[model samples]
Target: MGFKSLAGKFYAGIVQKQIEYQRKNAVSLQQKIFLYIVGEAATTKFGTDHGFSDIQTYEDFKKRVPIRDYEELRPYIDRVISGEENVLWPGTPAYLAKTSGTTSGVKYIPISKQSMPEHITAARNALLNYAYETGNTSALDGKMIFLQGSPELYELNGIPTGRLSGIVAHHVPGYLQSNRMPSYTTNCIDDWEEKVEAIVGETIKEDMRLISGIPPWCQMYFDRLSARAGGKKIKDIFPNFKLFVYGGVNYEPYRARIEESIGFKIDTIETYPASEGFIAYQDSQKDNSLLLMVDAGIFYEFVPAEEIFNENPTRLQLKEVELNRNYALILNTNAGLWGYNIGDTVKFVSKNPYKIVVTGRIKQFISAFGEHVIVEEVEQALMEVARKEGIDIVEFTVAPQITPADGGLPYHEWLIEFGHAPYDLKGFALKVDQALQEKNIYYKDLIKGNILQPLIVKSLKKNSFVDYMRIMGKLGGQNKVPRIANDRKIADQLTRYITN
Candidate 1:
């Protein structure tokens, strides 16, 4: 093994012991973090306004602080943006992570100095945990590519504001800098297509071992590499490539197409990260569930998914969460977000060490007719059917069709772009519809009662999603196509790309 691999192994051992301790004492660690954040921010404007000094228990905290989304919390965020120190957290924020918001045009989330290191550390520990678990540190000896946004930042009140991925690019450790690929100049390219082309040129001749990105973007890079290599598989282009690290969207939809491009199965790691915090990462090759970061300097609360829109929802702490139930994730972090609803929903697979799976976004679901089918259910149903039928799906989205042109019952419309179309499209649609019915009872009831018809599947031309995203100015860097939307806004525009 090389010197770098040896050092990685030794460091992985230390992180492994720490992981074990946290796993065994997950509740206590979370409790300790909760106390530390409250005490540290007691003097801040938000803390004092929320009666943080008078708070002594979780109940007191819950009663005083109501759950608020970005728009509701904008006043405090505005103060921070206008150059107020210690308004939200103690001292000034290190950076403002700019993200596209739905209701609000643009959101600038604070990344505090105290909370910044945890982002870098959590990511490092994920890789280190992999090395320790599998006893394979060879990936440390070669080039690694992280497909991400531009690292260039422009000042927003002199706080180095930019995309969260861009902000993170600046903090990559010195040891790994030599192994990181796509030269700094290439990464700063504004256009994603141009950047991918530049990246392929830079890493085509290197000893690439690890690649990381959101799945669709990684797929885009793989396609370019194959084209450049005169139709050779990705595995042939980079024989050393072993690990695929990804987040931001469910990988199952793209897994078959990606593996086909790679020409074989490969080891993969899944992570749950957001602008707000690094929530979890896959710690075991044997298990797909992500190990939640209980000790990552953030306090977590969960409201049952069904109750998310209610006037008052029950907020359960880490210790109170049960297995397999979907919950709207809430956060109270060192970044000064109090009772903040980050919009993502997660389901706990293991309560002992607090492992979770991202279920869907709180707002991203098909519930127009009160049959609230989520992203997880739709992804699972479609993937299961596709695997059985020997089909490959490139991309897809579901939206409720409230009114049919022929005056038939309303049904869910699935707009899919296929890599390999099934021999019998009608039969394939039937299987997927049945699978979805089995997964969601509300949808099943509507179908059985004749209130809704079986879902209709419409195929699109190749690269339809790519073209759509490009047209919308969201073709890269943390922008994912919505899997499920209650309305037809996305579905209507998608019709123009439909195959005849």
Candidate 2:
């Protein structure tokens, strides 16, 4: 295929346009970038011919606005739902990506007409760059299977609003049609019950060459497939499959179990997709870090990790950012989001400005017992403990709770899943405790000769976490079971079979 007809050229042109814009406005890049975004926002609402007539300068807009979350835009969302015009960007929102809000149960995130192509292109760039870097263009010619959310679309007052996957399925490049499986007509997102049947009955027949989704869902599908095939391996079921792409959450915990069940070692690609945008994705052969979609209709901002939730946090523009420094991401996108904190923390692995490693969520930490444990620290400790014990882990989550101990309440609890049964659970826990103590001063002070002791390891059944998510109505979608819970609420729910 010619480069002009390929998606890569289209994506490269977009990147070049961004670089040109940056170069032309080099004198006051920040102000010019903000002004351009504001102009886009204003023009969309009024008319294409009219631009930011109300706002003239960056300082004028900055003083008038404060950082706002989705809640602050609830009214606009309501108007969109009501089918009222001029509430949002003067056009009907093409699709609404249902996302789990931090405080709200579920939020319908509107994707504007102008920004849909940007989302599509960013996703394409992720794939193209992966193929270019890994020399795996052959995989693109093979069938691609997305073990994603249901293709079911929900109608709000006769308007479609549901999974974004459904929208993507309908709109992918036509040239790629020959390589797609589950033809567009039959690819609708059905409910979980239907999805399970489809997977076992029909969808698996595509001779799927590439698999994609959260690790838990991927595990669930394989389990069902294996069960139906009378304990047949993944390779036996689909001999053509070559790679597994997953993201939205850490894949390390479930890595061994997936390989064990599939009975083969497959190349893996990780992605970072949020309601705001498709942010980053791993190259096909690259395992170290994900490359950022730098030209994907967004200008990036980063706040130092230490100052993420501070009262007065300062942010760095893209040009001023450095590699290997942990920072909380904030974005200003063509989708009309400005200085929006997407609630993800990441660090660049290379000076290329595009490759990064997703450390963890901004608020996902276990500090209830004054341990101040972050995901990186916990993952590092677990890796070290596993190395020392010669055991592999399929999936694991930690929950800390206070139990009555000698004279007062002390933090006492831990849960883990093993790839192979350990020789001594208690001994392994002690080593992990010691490792954590050396790494975290807070844990050290809290456990210094105290009555608090490491609890027993609650060995979970194989694919137990996937089952838990299925029970919670979060299976086969973007929702993922929490990897680290500070309290016992989730753990207790998952462990209902055990008596206290």
Best-fitting candidate, measured by TM-score? 1
lDDT of 1 at 388: 84
Q: What's model 2's lDDT at 91?
A: 59
Q: In model 1, which runs have C-alpha deviations exceeding 4 angstroms?
A: none
Error of 2 at 263 (Å): 3.2
Give the alpha carbon lDDT tens digit for every residue of 1-500 in model 2: 44433554455556545544543554355445566667666745422323355778544554444445567657666777787654445456777777786566688776777667867776666665655555555455467777666556778755677777766666778876777665444455456545755766765666677788878778778888888889988888888777787878777766777887888877787877776777777754736587676655566778898787776676676566788788888876665555567777888776444568888767767777667676776777777888667688866777776654354655535556566857887788778777777777877777875644543456677656666767777766677766665677777876653322
TM-score of model 2 relative to the true fold? 0.84
Q: Please, what are the lDDT tens digits per residue for candidate 1 over residues 1-500? A: 89999999999999999999999999999899999999998999999999999988999999999999999999999999988999889988999999998668889999998888999999999999999999989999999999999888988777889999899999999999999988889999988899899999999889999999999999999999999999999999999899999999999899999999998999999988888999999999999999999988889999999998898999999999999999999999989899999999999999878899999999999987789999999999999999988899999999998989999999999999999998788889999999999999999999999999999999999999999999999998889899999999999999998887
Q: What's model 2's overall lDDT? A: 0.67
Count residue pairs with overlapping backbones in model 2. Answer: 6
Computed on alpha carbons, the lDDT of every model, listed in order, comes to 0.93, 0.67
